[model samples]
Target: MVQLGSRAGAPGRHVVLCAEQISKSFAGVRALHNVDFDLRHGEVHALMGENGAGKSTLMKILAGVHTSYDGSIQVEGQAASFSGVRDAEEAGIAIIHQELNLVPELSVAANIFLGREPLIGGVLIDRRSMIRAAERLLARLGVTIPPETRISGLRVGEQQLVEIAKALSLNARILIMDEPTSALSSSECDTLFKIVRQLASEGVAIIYTSHRIEEVLELADRVTVLRDGRRVVTAPIGELSRGAIISAMVGREITANESGKTAQDGAVVLSVRNLTLDTLGPHGWRRTLHGVSFELRRGEILGIGGLLGSGRTEILESIFGVSRGWRDGNIAIDGAPVDINSPADAYRLGVALVSEDRKERGLHLGASICDNVALPSIGVLSRFGLRSFASERALAADMVKRLSVRCSGIGQDVAALSGGNQQKVVIGKWLGTEPRILLLDEPTRGIDIGAKQEIYRLIFDLAAQGLGIIVVTSEMPELLLLSDRILVMCEGRQTGILARENATQEQVMRLAAPGMAAWSQVSAS
Candidate 1:
């Protein structure tokens, strides 16, 4: 853990970045009140807050993404005004947003040097040199990516690396990262942390934001608490434990999930046997899901646990009918075979999925909250080849109320909402479908504690109504609390199935670990 602060005014050491009495508002609703914050050179400053706590608003003001904020920002002991993101970059500040800003059609090199590419003799374009330069920059950040590869061909983790490389290419003095590790696996996160340490060593000021308190303690040199747009306290990482940080962030006590919930009423509602997908990949017709089988019951929550590339995602994909063609499978809903060839087909048969990646697979960010929330039920809102906008708005308003979604209005753009609110919209969209079965993939991964609690309550509510739910999550405590049973996968095989009564963190880890069990026997015990 990092120490909170050093002695006051000991020699020529002042903050490199400082904000005084910052305030912001939208339509008379104050998002951030008078808040003061600072970042010193060679320090990792963690910003802590919950949904609607105004952390993002403050960061946006500092990044110059919002010019209407009222504040005095001093850089290197001189007051400065930044009108736009470019101005901030020019001031040696860079922000890697949670939502990646890369163009998919462009190559890695092109994205890294997007607006400011090095020129050949200040005239002709130098493509080869740009690629080499991008490669070197990526290497410096401990990121391995092919510069010539199109960003569209990469996974979410690889694309995140591209964003980091872009920040490094600017040689920025201050770097801001918003939930950079929300989608990264353990190893990939290790790579990112290594780069953070390296940059801190070079005197680059860093402002880090994340929902994971443990990660903040491990990586941040100092922690800053923000609540309802007010600065609470700034302390060294070593000065605060995870419990204290959570209490400060939420302004309340949060009991950890110490024990697992007991399974109840386990009559199977969904059953699949001998499910196999033989698709040609880098390896020929490789068995991605080898005779996978599982059982889920009415009013039950089943968990699927595994690391990246452990076939956990494939199982969800197969169940949702999004995977490559599969063969010889017996899928039953209430002991009846159901044909599922597409998402619409599965949906019609009463199945809905909150996919693993929300931005790509779930939402249309440019669309309004009304449109996104009502998308799944548009047919019902449509009549005589015409849609009723009023009806759609009413339905959206109701769903928003039910989900406790925070937003400006149903007419507000989804992209403008906070990350947790955006995720709520995704769930609301699915809830509008009114499915009998729900498959959620990492549903609460990036959300704050308050929003997460809402989602958990919603899950239990849905299950209480007798809707069978299967959740795939990397967070073990979530599995313990939200799931009635867990199915562990290791390398495209079913390793073990533990009921909540018998499921311990150690048991789930063992089943999800290497060389445990095959997919054929993974159960919903």
Candidate 2:
């Protein structure tokens, strides 16, 4: 490593990177405005903001992903400009995006060294050398995944670590990370923290961005908050509190726990009985869900909690009629039996699902916001087999304003929007379908604190309007705060259901955990 400035823990070190008067715009909409940022060697500088707050736009400029920004960049106190990602990489700068970028069929080594694999005699690829190099990098970072393992074989957490390893393999001096731990579990997040600290200690300047407040408090050396495409505040991490960060990000005194849930004992809206789902795998037929039964009442928020592969997502997807290995299910709406063979069937019955993988299962990124939001309701908004563009635009415009989705216009592609904004579009699209029952899976998975509060408020408001909502989340606090009742699942089984007044995090986790003692007791009960 090329040592620079003082070692870790030494304040006032040598400046590694700086940006001045950075501004960017897209199609007449300013995404970033006069943003200035600087980073020192061996420091973790957290970029804080809600989605569409211009944090990503600023970082994209730094990483050479957006080269048209009006700004001046300095590296080692010398003016520099990058033409593309290649220029950024050559300048010792690299970024790991929140969305994992890897080919699933390839081995870990291949993904780590993609586009620049080692070669023998400057011709054929050197697979052996690449694997060895990848192994060395992973081992140095304390990651234990085998280099020969296919990327698809690893869990999401492991995949994240691989991304980190790939960035480090480039010997990047300035590392930009966006929402690096969003998909990780608690233990996995701890592991990532260790790796981050280790990298910082090695004199790497890390520009970290995340919606997680506690993480910023624990990991950041300095914090720069952006709001509405402008720099709001820049302060040392020690001088800021979680509440202060939240207040700065959203310009409001919104508490971290902004749950406004009240008493919910309305009539039953949806009911299920002995819903079993099966799938065929390499090992032949296997049950992904077994004898699951639950009831969702009108105006009730039902939270489902479980570990990965605990069949939490499977339950919601099965109900929406969109999941493999889904069969032998009995479903009813308002005490009337229903047959749903597909998502179309589910939609016709006034059921809407906001799927977990937004990229793959939810929104149409390449399409305009108007099209994506009006997708489910196109039939109703059409005349003589042609869409009424006026009504489509009106519906999208109304939902966008109602959801507070930050966008240039309804004509802009959904892909151009930020993650939170994209999520809001997904929800808005389903609302256009006019569903009585809403199923949300990991609804706020990667959204920031401010966006989360807004979403929670939306959920509360939707439930208040007598919509039955079922939410599946890995975050326990979200489960506890939003749900009128919580259901814990463990290994394809419905372990337990607890009322909001009596449900505890410990109790819910015990039931969600597969081998816990409470699992057997809850299943029996």
Candidate 3:
């Protein structure tokens, strides 16, 4: 490995990358404006801002993903202008995007060495050499994933690790990590932090971007915050507190832990009895969920907490009738048993699911905001057998206003909106259906602090309106904040349910830990 000159503990390291007067716009809208940034060798510089605050835009410009941006970049004190990602790579820059970019049909080794595979005799591909290299990289990261394993076979967190390994394979001097641990477990995050520190010690410059405040406080040497497409502040991590960082990012003090109105003891609205699900994996049928039971009451938020693959999302999928598996469960709405064999049935019964992956499952990116919001209510908005454009527009306009979606107009494409706005569109889409029961899976996954506050407020307002909500989140704080009653899951089973008064982080983790036998005692008590 090339040593650029280490300064692991020193904050005055030499600059490895710098950007001046960086500005980018999409169509006629300004996404970034005169943002200046610089990174030092062997330093983790965190770039923070709410969604659409131009962090992603600036990173794209640096990584050569957005070539039309107006900026001057310098590498090693030399003027650098990249026309494409290839140019950035040649300049020893690599970016691990927030979204995974891999071929699901390909093996891990193939993905790692994609577009630059080793060859024999200048013609034939050297598969054996590639697999060996991939194995070494995975081992270096302290993971045991086989090089020959297909990407589709791995979980989301494992896929993120592969992205990291792929970036490391480039031998880049500068690395940009965008929300790298959003899908990782706590143990996996610790491993990643170790690797990051080791790389920094070896003189690699890293620019980290995340909405996670604690991770930034722990990992970054210095932090820069942006807002409304402009640079707000840049300061050393030691000089910043959590409140300071959030204030700089959002331009306001946010009480993230402020308790909302307590849920009323309303009547039971939905109940599940001994729910079980069997999914068809590559190795045939595997039981994904077992004996999961819960009750959601009107004006209550029921939060599900668990590790990745611990059946948190599966529970929501099964309830929304979108699980790609055979499910055996008894579901009752208002004390009457109901059969939900498909999403249509669930919809007809006033059940709406805001999926975890908003880009893929929730919204149609290419469609207009009006189109996406009016999708679910199309049938109801139509006139007899004819489509009612006027009514659709009216419904879309109403939802956009109600959700406070920031957009030019309803005619704008959903893809052009920010991450936060896109999520609002997803929720608005479901709300148009006027569902009594709402299921939200990672509703604020990639969103920033300001948007999170908005969504939290929305949830509280919905519950106050007597909407029964079931939320599945990996964030412990979010789980504790939103739920009136928390259901902790481990593997496929229900561990225990803690009422809001008793739901501490320790108690939730104790129940969420796999192979723990304390559930019986907790349930009995």
If scored against the real structure, what TM-score would every candidate get?
Answer: 0.86, 0.86, 0.94
Local accuracy by lDDT, each model = 0.81, 0.85, 0.89
**Candidate 3 lDDT, 126-191, residue by residue in tens:** 999999999999988878888998999877778999999999999999999999988776667777
* lDDT measured at residue 264 in model 1 versus the true structure, 0 to 100: 69
The most accurate candidate by TM-score is: 3
Clashing pairs in 3: none
- Ranked by TM-score, the better of candidates 2 and 3 is 3
Residue 96 displacement in candidate 3 (angstroms): 0.7
Off by over 4 Å in 3: 1-8, 142-146, 153-155, 261-264, 517-521
Tens-digit lDDT string for candidate 2 (237-273):
8888888998999998885555546445689899999
Query: In order, what is each prediction's RMSD in angstroms?
Result: 4.0, 4.0, 2.8
Q: Estimate, for each residue in 1-525, the C-alpha lDDT of model 1 and write its tens digit.
A: 322232222113458999999999998889998999989887889999997788888888889898888879999998989899999999999999887899999999999999888888999769988999998988875666779888986667678788888888999999999888876755567677877877776678899999988789888878998988888888888789998888898899987543223436657678989777766543246776767788888888888887656777777777778887555577988888987878888888889989877878889988999999888888878988799888899889998898888887898998887667888899889888888889998898778977777778888888877888999887777878888888887777777888777888888877776667533464546
Clashing pairs in 1: 3-236, 4-235, 4-236, 493-518, 493-519, 494-518, 494-519
